[model samples]
Target: MRRDEVQVTLLYVFDELESDLGGTVSMREHSQVPESVTTIRDELRDSDFQVEALIAEGNPADMIVGVAADRDVDHIVVGGRQRSPAGKVIFGSVTQSVILDSDVPVTVVSVDAEGEGGDRP
Candidate 1:
Protein backbone atom coordinates (compact mmCIF):
# COMPACT_ATOMS: atom_id res chain seq x y z
CA MET A 1 0.00 0.00 0.00
CA ARG A 2 1.15 3.53 -0.65
CA ARG A 3 1.90 5.73 2.38
CA ASP A 4 -0.01 8.76 1.11
CA GLU A 5 -3.20 6.76 0.95
CA VAL A 6 -3.17 6.11 4.68
CA GLN A 7 -3.03 8.34 7.75
CA VAL A 8 0.17 7.65 9.67
CA THR A 9 1.02 8.22 13.29
CA LEU A 10 4.66 7.91 14.20
CA LEU A 11 5.01 6.82 17.81
CA TYR A 12 8.16 6.96 19.86
CA VAL A 13 8.03 5.16 23.18
CA PHE A 14 10.41 6.21 25.92
CA ASP A 15 11.29 3.21 28.03
CA GLU A 16 10.49 3.82 31.68
CA LEU A 17 13.40 3.24 33.96
CA GLU A 18 13.57 2.34 37.66
CA SER A 19 15.11 4.95 39.90
CA ASP A 20 17.21 4.35 43.00
CA LEU A 21 14.12 4.91 45.10
CA GLY A 22 12.29 2.24 43.11
CA GLY A 23 10.01 4.72 41.39
CA THR A 24 9.31 5.00 37.70
CA VAL A 25 11.61 7.37 35.86
CA SER A 26 10.01 9.27 33.00
CA MET A 27 11.63 10.59 29.84
CA ARG A 28 8.53 12.39 28.65
CA GLU A 29 10.43 15.66 28.68
CA HIS A 30 13.39 14.33 26.74
CA SER A 31 14.84 17.03 24.49
CA GLN A 32 16.09 14.93 21.62
CA VAL A 33 12.79 13.24 20.87
CA PRO A 34 11.07 16.34 19.55
CA GLU A 35 13.84 17.06 17.10
CA SER A 36 14.12 13.47 16.06
CA VAL A 37 10.40 13.04 15.59
CA THR A 38 10.28 16.29 13.71
CA THR A 39 12.98 15.08 11.35
CA ILE A 40 11.04 11.90 10.67
CA ARG A 41 7.75 13.70 10.26
CA ASP A 42 9.35 16.20 7.90
CA GLU A 43 10.85 13.42 5.81
CA LEU A 44 7.48 11.71 5.44
CA ARG A 45 5.83 15.00 4.68
CA ASP A 46 8.43 15.59 2.03
CA SER A 47 7.49 12.24 0.58
CA ASP A 48 3.87 13.41 0.39
CA PHE A 49 2.56 11.23 3.17
CA GLN A 50 0.01 12.37 5.75
CA VAL A 51 1.63 11.87 9.13
CA GLU A 52 1.82 12.88 12.79
CA ALA A 53 4.14 12.05 15.65
CA LEU A 54 3.34 10.99 19.21
CA ILE A 55 5.43 10.35 22.27
CA ALA A 56 4.47 7.89 24.99
CA GLU A 57 6.44 6.58 27.93
CA GLY A 58 6.35 2.89 28.87
CA ASN A 59 7.16 -0.57 27.58
CA PRO A 60 7.59 -0.28 23.82
CA ALA A 61 5.32 -3.14 22.86
CA ASP A 62 2.59 -2.20 25.31
CA MET A 63 2.67 1.45 24.30
CA ILE A 64 2.47 0.56 20.61
CA VAL A 65 -0.53 -1.73 21.09
CA GLY A 66 -2.22 0.73 23.45
CA VAL A 67 -1.75 3.64 21.06
CA ALA A 68 -3.08 1.58 18.16
CA ALA A 69 -6.17 0.72 20.19
CA ASP A 70 -6.62 4.26 21.49
CA ARG A 71 -6.23 5.78 18.04
CA ASP A 72 -8.24 3.02 16.35
CA VAL A 73 -5.56 2.49 13.76
CA ASP A 74 -6.23 0.02 10.93
CA HIS A 75 -2.77 -1.49 10.96
CA ILE A 76 0.43 -1.69 12.99
CA VAL A 77 3.99 -1.79 11.59
CA VAL A 78 7.04 -2.54 13.68
CA GLY A 79 10.73 -3.09 13.14
CA GLY A 80 12.44 -6.33 14.12
CA ARG A 81 16.07 -7.14 14.66
CA GLN A 82 17.74 -10.48 14.06
CA ARG A 83 18.54 -12.41 17.19
CA SER A 84 19.95 -15.78 18.13
CA PRO A 85 17.64 -18.45 19.50
CA ALA A 86 19.13 -18.17 22.97
CA GLY A 87 18.85 -14.40 22.89
CA LYS A 88 15.27 -14.65 21.75
CA VAL A 89 14.44 -17.03 24.59
CA ILE A 90 16.16 -14.89 27.19
CA PHE A 91 15.30 -11.32 26.14
CA GLY A 92 12.10 -11.79 24.19
CA SER A 93 11.17 -9.32 21.45
CA VAL A 94 9.03 -6.21 21.26
CA THR A 95 7.90 -7.05 17.72
CA GLN A 96 6.86 -10.51 18.85
CA SER A 97 4.93 -9.17 21.79
CA VAL A 98 3.05 -6.60 19.71
CA ILE A 99 2.19 -9.18 17.06
CA LEU A 100 0.77 -11.52 19.70
CA ASP A 101 -1.15 -8.80 21.56
CA SER A 102 -2.45 -6.44 18.89
CA ASP A 103 -5.96 -6.61 17.52
CA VAL A 104 -5.14 -4.94 14.22
CA PRO A 105 -3.14 -6.40 11.35
CA VAL A 106 0.61 -6.21 12.01
CA THR A 107 3.58 -5.83 9.64
CA VAL A 108 7.16 -6.47 10.59
CA VAL A 109 10.11 -4.96 8.73
CA SER A 110 13.44 -6.34 9.62
CA VAL A 111 16.69 -4.41 9.81
CA ASP A 112 20.00 -6.05 9.16
CA ALA A 113 23.16 -5.82 11.27
CA GLU A 114 24.24 -2.77 9.27
CA GLY A 115 20.90 -1.09 10.00
CA GLU A 116 19.79 -1.55 6.41
CA GLY A 117 16.13 -2.46 5.91
CA GLY A 118 15.19 -5.93 4.67
CA ASP A 119 12.47 -8.56 4.76
CA ARG A 120 12.57 -10.70 7.88
CA PRO A 121 14.25 -14.04 7.27
Candidate 2:
Protein backbone atom coordinates (compact mmCIF):
# COMPACT_ATOMS: atom_id res chain seq x y z
CA MET A 1 0.00 0.00 0.00
CA ARG A 2 1.15 3.52 -0.64
CA ARG A 3 2.33 5.27 2.50
CA ASP A 4 0.13 8.23 1.74
CA GLU A 5 -3.01 6.06 1.58
CA VAL A 6 -2.31 3.85 4.56
CA GLN A 7 -2.16 4.97 8.17
CA VAL A 8 0.60 3.39 10.22
CA THR A 9 -0.16 2.52 13.81
CA LEU A 10 2.83 1.73 15.94
CA LEU A 11 1.69 -0.59 18.70
CA TYR A 12 3.68 -1.26 21.84
CA VAL A 13 2.31 -3.79 24.34
CA PHE A 14 3.72 -3.93 27.84
CA ASP A 15 3.57 -7.50 29.11
CA GLU A 16 3.64 -6.15 32.63
CA LEU A 17 0.88 -3.84 33.79
CA GLU A 18 3.37 -1.71 35.65
CA SER A 19 5.36 -1.08 32.50
CA ASP A 20 2.53 0.94 30.99
CA LEU A 21 1.55 4.32 32.34
CA GLY A 22 -2.13 4.10 33.24
CA GLY A 23 -3.04 7.64 32.24
CA THR A 24 -3.21 8.98 28.74
CA VAL A 25 -0.06 10.63 27.45
CA SER A 26 1.12 11.83 24.11
CA MET A 27 4.02 10.00 22.48
CA ARG A 28 6.35 12.89 23.35
CA GLU A 29 5.40 12.64 27.01
CA HIS A 30 5.98 8.91 27.10
CA SER A 31 9.55 7.91 27.91
CA GLN A 32 9.29 4.11 28.14
CA VAL A 33 9.43 2.20 24.84
CA PRO A 34 11.80 0.16 22.78
CA GLU A 35 14.36 2.25 20.98
CA SER A 36 13.36 0.61 17.71
CA VAL A 37 9.83 2.04 17.98
CA THR A 38 11.26 5.55 18.35
CA THR A 39 13.60 4.99 15.42
CA ILE A 40 10.79 3.65 13.26
CA ARG A 41 8.59 6.58 14.21
CA ASP A 42 11.30 9.04 13.19
CA GLU A 43 11.79 7.27 9.90
CA LEU A 44 8.08 7.14 9.15
CA ARG A 45 7.80 10.83 9.99
CA ASP A 46 10.21 11.41 7.11
CA SER A 47 7.93 9.48 4.80
CA ASP A 48 4.34 10.00 3.65
CA PHE A 49 2.65 7.75 6.19
CA GLN A 50 0.49 9.22 8.95
CA VAL A 51 1.85 7.45 12.01
CA GLU A 52 0.06 6.91 15.30
CA ALA A 53 1.76 5.20 18.19
CA LEU A 54 -0.32 3.21 20.68
CA ILE A 55 0.87 1.79 23.97
CA ALA A 56 -1.04 -0.60 26.23
CA GLU A 57 -0.31 -3.14 28.94
CA GLY A 58 -1.58 -6.66 28.40
CA ASN A 59 -0.79 -9.89 26.61
CA PRO A 60 1.13 -8.56 23.64
CA ALA A 61 -0.40 -10.81 21.05
CA ASP A 62 -3.90 -10.35 22.35
CA MET A 63 -3.55 -6.61 22.50
CA ILE A 64 -2.17 -6.47 18.98
CA VAL A 65 -4.89 -8.55 17.46
CA GLY A 66 -7.55 -6.79 19.48
CA VAL A 67 -6.39 -3.38 18.33
CA ALA A 68 -6.26 -4.46 14.73
CA ALA A 69 -9.77 -5.82 14.93
CA ASP A 70 -11.03 -2.79 16.79
CA ARG A 71 -9.45 -0.31 14.42
CA ASP A 72 -10.57 -2.20 11.31
CA VAL A 73 -6.99 -2.09 10.15
CA ASP A 74 -6.19 -3.28 6.66
CA HIS A 75 -3.10 -5.13 7.75
CA ILE A 76 -0.79 -5.67 10.67
CA VAL A 77 2.96 -5.29 10.47
CA VAL A 78 4.95 -6.50 13.45
CA GLY A 79 8.60 -6.93 14.32
CA GLY A 80 9.99 -10.29 15.37
CA ARG A 81 13.16 -11.19 17.18
CA GLN A 82 15.16 -14.32 16.48
CA ARG A 83 15.23 -16.67 19.39
CA SER A 84 16.27 -20.20 20.13
CA PRO A 85 13.63 -22.90 20.48
CA ALA A 86 14.12 -22.92 24.21
CA GLY A 87 13.62 -19.21 24.44
CA LYS A 88 10.48 -19.41 22.35
CA VAL A 89 9.15 -22.14 24.55
CA ILE A 90 9.95 -20.16 27.68
CA PHE A 91 8.73 -16.76 26.60
CA GLY A 92 6.28 -17.71 23.85
CA SER A 93 6.22 -15.85 20.54
CA VAL A 94 4.14 -12.74 20.26
CA THR A 95 4.58 -12.49 16.51
CA GLN A 96 3.63 -16.10 16.10
CA SER A 97 0.48 -15.60 18.07
CA VAL A 98 -0.40 -12.45 16.14
CA ILE A 99 0.14 -14.21 12.84
CA LEU A 100 -2.02 -17.09 13.92
CA ASP A 101 -4.76 -15.02 15.49
CA SER A 102 -5.06 -11.92 13.37
CA ASP A 103 -7.87 -11.85 10.84
CA VAL A 104 -6.13 -9.28 8.67
CA PRO A 105 -2.98 -9.74 6.65
CA VAL A 106 0.15 -9.68 8.75
CA THR A 107 3.69 -8.78 7.78
CA VAL A 108 6.50 -9.83 10.05
CA VAL A 109 9.68 -7.77 10.10
CA SER A 110 12.79 -9.34 11.48
CA VAL A 111 14.37 -7.15 14.10
CA ASP A 112 17.31 -9.53 14.37
CA ALA A 113 20.79 -8.11 13.91
CA GLU A 114 21.22 -9.92 10.60
CA GLY A 115 18.67 -7.64 8.95
CA GLU A 116 20.05 -4.37 10.37
CA GLY A 117 22.56 -3.45 7.69
CA GLY A 118 20.57 -0.51 6.36
CA ASP A 119 17.70 -2.95 5.83
CA ARG A 120 14.80 -0.52 6.07
CA PRO A 121 13.54 0.85 2.81
How many angstroms is residue 14 displaced in model 2 relative to the true structure, after the best TM-score fit? 1.1
After superposing candidate 2 on the true structure, give the runs of residues whose Cα lies further than 4 Å from its correct spot.
17-31, 113-118
Which tens-of-lDDT digit does each residue in 11-112 have in candidate 2? Answer: 887764333557433443444677777778888978878999888877789999999999999999887888999999988999999999999999987777
| Candidate 1: clashing pairs of residues | none
The Cα RMSD in angstroms, rounded to one decimal, for candidate 2 relative to the true structure is 5.3
How accurate locally, in lDDT, is each candidate?
0.83, 0.81
Q: Residue-pair clashes per candidate, as listed?
A: 0, 0
Q: List the candidate 1 regions with Cα displacement exceeding 4 Å.
A: 1-5, 19-21, 27-31, 34-39, 113-121
